[model samples]
Target chain A: MADKPLILAVDHNRRNLELMSQFLGQEGYEIIAAASLEEFDQVLGKQADIKLALVDIAGFDRSVWERCERLRAENIPFIIISPRQSAAIQQAGLAHGARGVLVKPLAVKELLGLIRSLLGE
Target chain B: MSEKRLPTGIPGLDEVLQGGFIPGRAYLARGGPGTGKTTLGLHFLTAGAANGEKALFITLGEPEAMIRQNAERMGFDLSNVAFLDLSPTPEFFAQVETYDIFSPAEVEREPTTRKIVEQVEKLQPSRVFIDAMTQFRYLAADPFQYRKQVLSFLRFLVERGTTVLFTSEGSAEAPDADLQFLSDGVIDLEYAPEGRILAVTKFRGSDFLSGRHSMRLGERGMEVFPRLVPEVYRREFALEVISSGVPELDELLHGGLERGTITIITGPSGVGKTTLGLQFMKEAAGRGERSVVYTFEEGVETLVGRCEAINIPVHAMMERGTLEVVKVEPLRYTPDEFARLVRREVEEEGSHIVMIDSIAGYRLSLRGEDLVSHLHALCKYLSNMGVTTLLINEVEYITGEFRATEVGISYLADNIIFLRFLEMRGELHKAIGVLKKRLSDFEKTLREFQITRYGVKVGAPLTGLRGILSGTPELIE
Candidate 1:
């Protein structure tokens, strides 16, 4: 698990954060969890080899998009986790260079497959 | 099999189907832009929604927002519809599709199928409409893969009892050839210089009206007028003589117009052909039989006004709901569409009298159809339905060497009522003559005709004159 690719998870809800961390951790990926944009920035500041990011863009603010932009600048692929199955939400995520937009509570199999492809597994 | 059918919520279309589309099967609507394909699909889904059935509209062409706006404008409420909008908006038009074309499997096929399947599974809709199914043609450049995806999608939907309708913008050469075999039926709409036409090219298990029928778009949306097949509508009618409301005109018509017969009033313009037809229409209304007037050259208000001035009581008859006036825009209607209007009034609304104000206006609109033959067939159908028909034809020259009509519809007309404008003694005069009446004898003498404030007044025969039938009269010494 420790040798697995480091994946960052950003979400405002603590339960969703814990669930994602546990699920991805059990799937043999090293996980870093953040509850806010400030915490996400702090995590990115300390990490040098973050492989992929999963950001919950539900009720997302300007800072959330800025974080996506930052990840885009770093050549790090990311996925948008939204509570809506709306085209507008998916389009907004795609506009920001997100690899994919999946609705929650996540399609676990599809999400894992997406993570594997994004990480070049 | 008529197991179950998905009703396409367009007026007169189901009648063409003899029922409706088969349930759990896929049908394709093929047409070009401005052919009302998208509008028809919306009607299908909205109708399903109205029936308490879940419905979905997956648009791959126009933005769903624009579609919604258009549907609303057409008086369709789509609040109950679930949409899978994969189309890009104007703001996102410039985004490059980095859909990994190098490996077609992962990029296009999975997303397109998965998106649709996921949405359908979520909504569990009974009816689905896929707009611009041809977009998939571009997505999968490899024809084999495109066919495979579409076939599988159809199979999957049918298995789940999800009846489907998809629209395509097939080119003129072979618009629906690519995926036609995969569909259970194909309803083809064509917009040509001649007119808009629709046909059911193929249907797997059900019978449908096959030949190209005329289609038109109006305030009520798309309506298909199945070709007036006369044989199917032939029936016997009571040979009762109906009054023309004008006592003198009725006397000339041998106690009035006969049921299930065609009477054409031929003359140049402004010779009271329309008013003559209106008199017969007013007579039908008085007897409590419904009548419909297809006013191609005149407005309803103007026709009604003309009738009221002559004490025809057109307004009272209209307000009584015994008569209907359909003012037609010549360029906007086809002969078949006009036929459908007449059929609807007769069959559905129980109209007993059918009148076309002037054939010249009808000819201009539906000129693609051979004019005389089309009118012949339409009149035959009306007569078969036990309805009295009056067609007014305008001659080209008001006072030329006498001709029966410009188009020579004499043989087709069961009765020829000839009205003419003459230069009698340097004074403009009009004459009405019965050229032929198939069912009975008519007055052979020409009558001096006048349009009065109280209506048409006809005088005794002008026995002292000759050559009046040739536009110039001479006294016989």
Candidate 2:
């Protein structure tokens, strides 16, 4: 197992994806990025070390859920990132086996705390 | 397809959507700056919260704090709505570039789409609003890649049963036709120089009432007015003229005023336009005719005082339950709300006659590109209801040969009465003329008039005014 937690981030917006990746990358964790579900699937197939995936809920559709479900079945923990923090969404995320929900314009420190709690860091 | 829709709570907007936004279907709102797109989106989200649906707003270009401040300024409560900031970073761009095996530079430039999907799965909001989508344009150099990323993001949202409204700054250069075409619905907002009017260019999958309508951003978010179509205009039929409360003036109108027809009492400023409107209301009330006066130019106190001076006894009518007065400061009400209010009064009060103190006041209050269309819709609505309507319009130069130059309004009036200031021998005198009366045959000749403590009195026509046709009248020697 990798000593540092492995995180995969997916988003269509380059700026957001970059920001989240950099924020998480500097905190002594390995970060991977994918622009689409197809690319994300390919990355998962190639790299099995990713322990957590951060997904942007805005403008995302069902294939994303399918992929997340597959990851959950494999016992890999995932966190849902969204601009909206509605109770319904949070509940849905939790029910879908995500460890927790992270509302965006993300705070690096808060996200780190959540990851540590989920991974026993 | 089986997903639920979120109601926007805007009067006409929900109707346009055939109820509300399609539940779980993402939509695109495209516009240029000052188009009220953001305000509209915010209104939808806030209204959703009020309706017991949770809303989440994600800001890409602007700071979350600034978004909250602006929402408050627009009178929207964001306390119930969630805010998230997920701005892109550089290393994320590098990771996305690694996947672009074709171009190393592209790999370094594009952002990851997987991260965004992860966030959506986590938040699982019922409704989502992305402040803007322009930020993604730089992620992929090729349009194909950009489309793929956008499609993937949208698909993720739809699968989770999330209704999303994405705003994009429409650019004249390299318009995003592909993005617009991909969305379930598109609303184009435009701002024009004339009258500073905002108009909705088009809305797909709906029976959109065509024509430029007016919109304004005021203390109450964005208000839209759907303009009238040409098919609703009709010829006036001869009906009973109800008294305007001023006994003698009612005689000048050949009775009271025609019922179920538009009677336009136009004049220059300070010619008792509002006073005449109030008088009509008082008369209608005295006869047990339910009536309401919506005034844009005067305050409630001013209207009451002016009626008191004329001894019309407006307060007595109000007390008797036959009259209702609504004094509107144009800035406070949106055109849509104003129209809705009129509909309510007509329905609830069973008002026989409706009076707008001055059309100019209405115009100034709901300043939008579709001024004519808005008036058309208002007139059509009232006329179709068979409600006798009186509209007062103030003209700057009322002295000209009776002509209506303002666009899209002259044809709307069943009767046009011109009140002018006639200059004779270095003295200014008021005059009244029936320029056009659709139902009744009247004297077309211009006649002199006087305003006294008693009210308006008609006199003989000025025989030798050569330049009256030009609006600059010259007195006969």
Candidate 3:
């Protein structure tokens, strides 16, 4: 797992996003942190080898979801991180072909496993 | 009674339930920690889901992911089932909600109950399992409130045509009878000397086997064996003759041992008790009837080799599936498990002859001291199945005085064959005689027996002998 691929994580909370980034970084993934779609776009420009994205998808606007569609078209996979996980969220997540949706306050071990599996590590 | 029943999926449990659980009723499976209560609940949901019915597992203690992982390991696919995670998730703890009006239990249970009601209304699942039902009990401040809430929930589920199975960890704090009274049936699992035992304490409208069934909980989940009550399995078997491989020995018993009877062969060690049983099993194989020899003392290889040395085709018979030698691990097999194994061999494999090599060795495998009683029941069961069984009992004394067997199991047997070592002119000799054969005239004369590479040799009667019953007979002048 040397020369790990970069993963971009987008969250509304700075501390939560940084904590997840640090935890995954220790697990050998190079994490790029982003707070919004603007920052995610900036990170995408800088990092050519972004393996996957973990983004929050629990707002009224369709901007985050449309970005997810664009990512899917670019052959990049993403998993949604929502504050609330329900059957509707899961269905929406499946329709978008997002890897899966993780509820907020994530179990660190489960998050790590999901990241590792998606990264093919 | 005829009613709409659902199978429990666990082997032998349906038989104990006398058909299966009455559907659309709530059942409680109560057990201590690690006693397989959760697994049993999952089995019910899985069985329902497999039958194209929607199922729901509402976990109150463990997370849905952990439950799904454990269920998958046991070969249960829960894809069709929905999960209502009532346990406090990370967000539940993080969210700050003011709860000044409700008590501690109500603070937790209100939202959980609302979620369950919503899920049931939406999914309309036919089966629902509520794990750690005791958690709700703990939430309620008093016993009466807890009982009322549970009864209401059970009634709600049953009214919607949902068959429910709830699990409770039997603890000292919470009373199990509270749940037992509310549920339509109660399956109580407990740790016993032999293994875990599952018993149905109550079934509201149906009659179930009112005894503890031996249960095993492993990766494949629970397996229960209803207690082997011999009287229930009895049937009428014909009085046909089944011979031993040795021709002369068969002559001593008129024709041979009658079918559906237990034949006890008592002898000292190294006096050919096991070999004689093998001879009968070999003959059973030759007659195209299958046989199973459960040797509690020796290994299968040694038994096969010894039988092969006597020109007996133990290996060949096994190769053709006519004979099977099963070595019962010492102190491992319970009488319940052993009886089930024999029943499977006879009922499933169609084996006609059953043999337990030595009673003493078999006793070492039993948990309780009532080895004779167990043997009596098992022999009766085998006889009723029309399976002829042979038991070898090794005695303590070799000569001077003869007792048929040390275990006092002789009376339970329909026929008794006594083998002894006799010293004649400073040379040791083997003798075989039939002491008792119920309703059959068997010759009482002692015959000289020998174990050679060519198999058991039964010679003519030792005619010039007196006081033979004393084990030390003198030749007449």
Candidate 4:
């Protein structure tokens, strides 16, 4: 289990975080879920085994970009999930070194394929 | 083998269906809100329950408690009916966090399907009613998947020998055309300016009545009135004439109006057209035959009083069960509903003579529908039943132009007995004559007509007068 690739999932919604854990867990990947900024920072402190991240940027302040910058410096590949898509949001997400920006209501197949490719599995 | 039918708990609806729904098949009741779709489903389930069959109501849009309460008030006994309450609860809103990530089709469909399958296996109900099957559309990721799921779900129930009746609340944005196509039968409910109409457009494996029948949603729940088809009802009768109990009047009509034929007693207002119809009924009453007068323009008491003043003895006739005067309020009933009332009188009460007080009042009751077609169907139906029908047609014009019937419905009349207001010798007088008689030859002469406290009096043919139809007559030398 320790040798299994680990992923960090952050969302303000507990049910969405649990759904991601259950879906990705069935694919043989370990998950670390955080429902708030405080929990996200605590998981980030001990995130040495974290292979990738999926951050849903809803219900967060502007300080969330700082965390994204910190993830980039740590050389972690992550995807940003937004409630809506726009050119400004896409440009901002890319400037923050996100691997991809996905809108909310993500398709399960697309989300799984992106996670597999990001983990190089 | 003859197909087994399950009555829909509505007798009129069963008649429209020719028997009832085909057993072990799925039917879709499609309509907008407040069109009685759910109420129709309740009738289906309760009907099965009454027959000692296990019935299940799967409520998705409305709570089961509310449905049971409503059905109870409508005199429906839901004691033996089982309910599968799949409607959303307070917990659904409390757990709003589950709305995203996985689609509802992925997260919710499994448990919903499991619950339905488990309940069905345990109870094994013979009838299933889904309040609104459109709720399943939310449990599907796409339209194609929704169609497939619905097809399989219906198949599963039908294979178990369960007759399914489902409702769909369709909208302009999301029409249930696909579900309609998949259904073995489709009953569409619509609200029109006249009244609520229900039509069965598609019925597989059997035939159904093919027009928009009238429906009513009242305290007793939904009631359907099938359209009257004249060719379907017939009775053999002799080609005999009925007398008007008057010597001169019967002479003008050759004998009198023929049995099983339609007569139009047309005249201006207050020209005693209705009294003339009552004259024939008075004679029938002396013979112990029943007559029903559907008075659309006058109250029952008013008409009865007028007839009594003319020595018709309508009160005695009603007391003896030989006459009934029905007051049909305007805009109160659809044409089909009025036809049903007449049918009850003729078919059940054994009425020999049926009279509609006036044609214009009947047209007014129709709201805005075509008067001629409705009257034609009713008259044809009455004719087929071998019942003498008298229509009191009040033309708009009291005089001047020579017209037999102003409403342009003389073609519907088997005998046209027209009364005219003529000016003779600078005095306003009434003249009665026969314009057309389809069955026999009528006297080609106009006679003086008068209504008195004694009764109707007809004089000899006024051969000395000409231009009687022009409302101004001249003496012939």
The prediction achieving the highest lDDT against the true structure is 4
Model 2: per-residue Cα lDDT at residue B188: 68
Highest DockQ: which candidate?
A: 4
Q: TM-scores of the models, in the given order?
A: 0.70, 0.60, 0.78, 0.88
Docking class of 2: incorrect
List the lowest-lDDT window of 10 residues for candidate 3 chain B: B97-106
> For residues B342-398, what per-residue lDDT tens digits would candidate 4 score against the true structure?
999998999999999888888887653876798899999999999999999887888
- Candidate 4 chain B has its poorest 10 consecutive residues by lDDT at B95-104
Best by TM-score: 4
**lDDT by residue for model 3 over B376-422, one digit each (tens)?**
88898998888888998988988878888887788888899999998
DockQ sort, best first: 4, 1, 2, 3
Model 1 agreement with the true structure over B168-229: per-residue lDDT tens digits? 88887645587788898888888888788888888888788768788877665677788777
For candidate 1, what is the TM-score?
0.70
CA displacement after TM-score superposition, residue B43 of candidate 1 (Å): 1.8
What is each candidate's fraction of native interface contacts (fnat)?
0.00, 0.00, 0.00, 0.67
DockQ of each: 0.03, 0.02, 0.01, 0.49
Give the CAPRI rating of model 3: incorrect
Q: Which stretches of candidate 3 lie over 4 Å from their true place?
A: A1-121, B91-102, B234-236
Q: What lDDT tens digits, residue by residue, belong to model 2 across residues B210-313? A: 54455666778876654434244443445566665544454456665577788787887876666666666766676787888888867887777777776667
Residue A38, candidate 4: C-alpha displacement in angstroms? 4.4
